[model samples]
Target: MESMEPGTVRPGGRTARVRTAVLQAAGDILAERGYSHLDLADIARRAGVGKTTVYRRWGTVTGLVADLLADMAEQSLPRTETGSLLGDLKANARLVQRTLADSRQGPLFKAVIAAATGEARTAEALRHFYDVRVDEWAPCVQQAIDRGEVPEGTDTHEVIRAVSAPLYYRLLAGGGRIDVAAADRAAEAAATAARAGVFLSEGRPR
Candidate 1:
């Protein structure tokens, strides 16, 4: 598909193709050059689109990163629904593990995290990335509640966030290895916490 410049809208049928190309090129740049090295002109050239288009569409590197994160959220895996909460959490953990284990995504995330350390907009974009993933998996927690597996007022978002926190810690902090076993541990921890009412309220229903 021919790449369209960032802000340049092509024919209706080609819009998706253009967006895909732009996001792919952005991701490639993020992975290869780090955030500080990213330039709209370079992204346009790599995407085979016009520099003006990239400039008009994204305006800045932070803007491009935000859109890239949004696109990633759109393409992220749907949450699993195994019979048990642990099983479902394990599935979610594995999905996150697989994504982080990917060479391109791994570096792209590192670049984003590095950029976020210094840039407010980049930090917001990074937050958006986690928010999207957390939202995606929250329904699983709700399902667990519906099945009476956990307390009714459990904080689903926190439950979901707990599942990926360690994986990301390993990816960003170099504190540990990220593997299936690690994922299982994360899932188990989250499940255990959920079971122990860590995410639930102490008071009566309000």
Candidate 2:
């Protein structure tokens, strides 16, 4: 069979299956050994697919990692609605904290973040991954504005990022514990700031 080109979208059928298996293998290898140890042939073997298939479809390990991040963004859980901005944000924070605190996911994210620090393409892909997640949660912030819980003209995306930033900082720093208290504090800070217009387009509370 002819091999698909790198970066092509294969959403269903046999091609989808191949893409799924290859990405799964790529993720496993990434989680286990980080990006430096990811090899096309090794991933193909682990995924039980032809090396040519993975090579043709992804072109390089960076490409494979980029695709994996894209798929992760696509698979991310939808925002939770709790009828209040703080409640919604707390849910978001806890979700981020849990993912970062998970043994497998923690190391995997650390590996990807470290790789992105040195590789420009990986960095762009990682940015895209965060963009997708932020976009997903931004609507909840907008809802807060609609409810008058937050002031008008606030940056919804920024507010959402605020909710997750401290949790990510703790995860990356390894200097502080990321527990339920930390998550709640992060959410509360963002919510408080949003209500105070700290996330306004002007970037300061009026």
The candidate that wins on TM-score is 2
Off by over 4 Å in 2: 1-12, 203-205
- Candidate 2 differs from the real structure by a C-alpha RMSD in angstroms, to one decimal, of 5.8
The residue-by-residue lDDT of candidate 1 on 9-101, one tens digit each, is 334466566666777898888888888888888888999887887888789888988888777765566777898899999998988888777
- TM-scores for all candidates: the values are 0.88, 0.90
Clashing pairs for predicted structure model 1, backbone only: none
| Superposition TM-score, candidate 2 onto the true structure | 0.90
How does model 1 fare in lDDT?
A: 0.80
Cand. 2 Cα-lDDT: 0.84
* Candidate No. with top lDDT: 2
CA error at residue 115 for candidate 1, angstroms: 1.5
Residue 87 alpha-carbon offset, candidate 1, angstroms:
0.8
